[model samples]
Target: MTDTFKHHLELLIACVIYGTVGIYMQQLEDMSIGSIIFYRIFFGLTALLFYLSITRNLGQLALKRKKKYLLLLGILYVLQMFSYYSAIR
Candidate 1:
C-alpha cells in the first residue's frame, strides 16, 4: 500500500477504536473508574513496549537529557486519562 493509504487506514482503525471506548466503559461499570483506567494504561503500555522491543527501538526510550520534561508529560497524561475516565463514568 502507498504511505498515504496506509496512514488513512491506520487513522480509520483508530477512530473506530476510539468510538467504542465508551461502549466498553459502560459494560465495565461494575469496576471502579480508577481500576479501569489502570488496566487501560497498563495494557497500552504493555503493547507499546512489545512493539518497541520487536522493532529494536526499546533503547530509544533511554534519555540522557530532558528527563524532567518526560516525567512531567507522563504525569499530565495520567491526570488527563483519570479525568477522562471519571467523566465517562
Candidate 2:
C-alpha cells in the first residue's frame, strides 16, 4: 500500500479500537473511572510518542508545526477527554 493508504488504514483500525473501548472498559470492576482514563491517556501518549520517534517524525513535527496549533490541539484534547471521563463516570 502507498504511505497515504497505510496511514488511512491505520486510522481505520484506530477507530475500531476506540469503538470497543466503552464496552471493554465497562467489563472491568474495582477500578475507578479516573484510573481508566489515566491508563488510556498514558499508554496512548506513550504509543504515539514511540511511533513518532521511530518514524523520525518528532523532529520534523517540531520544526514544521506551529506552537499555537499545538496549544489549541492540547486544549481540545483535554476537553474531549474530560467529556469522555464524565460520560464514563
The TM-score values for the models, in the order shown, are: 0.81, 0.61
Winning candidate number (TM-score): 1
Per-model clash counts, in order, read: 0, 0
lDDT by residue for model 1 over 27-82, one digit each (tens)? 99899877887898899999999999999999988898998999999899889878
- Tens-place lDDT per residue, model 2, 1-89, is 89999999999999998777678766855777657767877998899999999998886555465888888988788778768756765
How many steric clashes does model 2 contain? 0
Candidate 2 error regions (>4 Å):
1-12, 63-65
Top lDDT hit: 1
Cα lDDT, model 2, residue 45: 86
